[model samples]
Target: MKHGRNLPKLGRKAAHRDAMLSNMAASLILHHRIVTTKQKARALAPFVDRLIQTAKNGKKSLSARRLVARQLYSPEAVEKLFSDTAPKMSDREGGYVRIYRLGRRVGDGAETAVVTIGMATIKVDKKEKKEAKKHKGERPAGYDRTKDEEIFLEKAAAKSKTAEESAEEAKAS
Candidate 1:
């Protein structure tokens, strides 16, 4: 009985499949759209959708970012997913990704598809847009960057020092 065991193997080992999916998901997050074999695109759509769903959970708390980071394997991609991509779909309940068939590949004639974030076509509601704006970490309108830079630099230095200390402790242990 092959019940409930439906993740496509994609002709690769578990680690290889996971790694490929992680990379593809990161690329999708960074680029917003990607082209690949239909099989791979189908496999990737749900994977990316789940990540987007997780990203829709309010503002990017440290814990939420860390959870998505574990699956994305790219810090920048995870950051974009939470800060940018996720907010666009915050109002939508599910189906965060869309796949379009693009005829076939040139070499092996494999079926190809374009996977994209679903928010590109839909008009966002005003209320949702306002809510999304609050989570984006944008400065207040007409804010003065010159005055803020000092505070920003101080916070950045402190964060880096803590990170370095943690790394050093791990090494010593």
Candidate 2:
């Protein structure tokens, strides 16, 4: 019996290796970048790239992230997050990562690649924020009350029901 299977079963054990890669991939997604062995980067690049591409489609639901986290089970995945990935791609509509081939690894002979995801910008309505500031003391959306108008409403609400209206309503009820 072996006492320490403590480390991740990275290679040779295939499924476990895949799981480890997936975990690393998820983290890379959230963090936007990570440094690792060239072999690992190579394997992880495709997985994480695809994951970000999935998020690019705007299916960035809690369920999707949770499912990704389940496949990835890595602390990195949750922390690194796809928040940027989804929003960035929300504009472009496709193709997230661009892989650049770097030279060989220092330790091992594995080939290195720098995988970058496209963080395109979508111009959101800054005017909405401006409008919000302008209307700060004014009514909320769909509320057409001016400050004076709102005060009038508040006073109207504060007023005791008129006896005739109350009596009529009471009679109707």
Candidate 3:
């Protein structure tokens, strides 16, 4: 009898668990990342993946939106799921989410984890690293170090020249 009932109860009744999972899934959809207990994160990852899969399948279909809406219950989250999140994951088959364990909590000692959409990290080349070191301050807003190194350096040099000119003008004044 207990053979197939292997899902974690999470110390909650069926309705409570469903509601919690729905809310958590909606939050994850809207925010793209969340922090929670390890067990909960594990439980949520599959749920979110399924939702993303549904969104990917449906795309702009009404039935798919309705199906996802039933589980998420948030119109904004549903829109984000269908419009933004799903399209980004269109090429991927599965495993849309990732979980990172964060060791134990300080107060209760419960293990924590970060659940997030699988975002790709940009690799920094040796030349870029050397260029980044040459300019030793925070990059300007909208400047992507990985993609626009030369543009960033050009802007930095322009800014430095402007700053020096302003200083010289001030001294002359």
Candidate 4:
């Protein structure tokens, strides 16, 4: 009976649906996360992720951001879509958006999902170690820790001598 109506109208007029999608896309870009109906989130993720991928290489191009803005309706959202989030997403070839199921909405019991920007965690040991060391304290120019750990050499020498003298007296020789 309900033929040729595959797309979910989302109970909105055509213009309103377009506007809603545009705003949702922009918010998703700028905030890197957004909440919406499960169906809408599923429809939006791949489309928005592809757009972010496109935005990555288009940072300097005014036309590119404008085009995205036209589709998205917000100038600032477009700016950040091009500048901040896109570059981070550039490294990944695809799959730049994630959808998490958040159960049902209270009003009408409609299903909801959270859409988020995808990021991979890099666990390179050396880089993490370097960052950790930098956070612990300020180091001088040309800093050398292996060399400075030897600053305890004087204390070690004193302890050794005390141990040696005490051992000699115990030996009674």
What TM-score do all the candidates reach, one by one? 0.66, 0.48, 0.68, 0.61
Higher-ranked by lDDT: 2 or 4:
4
lDDT for every model? 0.87, 0.62, 0.88, 0.79
The parts of candidate 3 lying over 4 Å away from their true place are 1-5, 120-173
**For all the candidates, what are their Cα RMSDs to the real structure?**
20.3, 18.8, 13.9, 14.4
Model 3: per-residue Cα lDDT at residue 136? 72
Clashing residue pairs in candidate 1 (N, C-alpha, C atoms within 3 angstroms): none
- TM-score-sorted candidate list, best first: 3, 1, 4, 2
By summed lDDT, the worst window of 10 consecutive residues in model 3 runs over: 115-124
Across 22-100, the per-residue lDDT of candidate 4 in tens digits comes to 8888888777788899999877876687677668767779777766766877888877777778877766788888888
The C-alpha stretches of model 4 lying farther than 4 A from their native spots are 1-7, 120-173
- Cα lDDT tens digits, model 3, 1-173, are 45685667899998898889999999988888888999999888888999999999988899999999999889999998888999999888999988888899999999999888875322489998998898778777787666677878889999999999999999999
Off by over 4 Å in 1: 1-5, 121-173
- The candidate scoring highest on TM-score is 3
What CA RMSD would candidate 3 show? 13.9
Candidate 3: residue 104 Cα off by (Å): 0.7
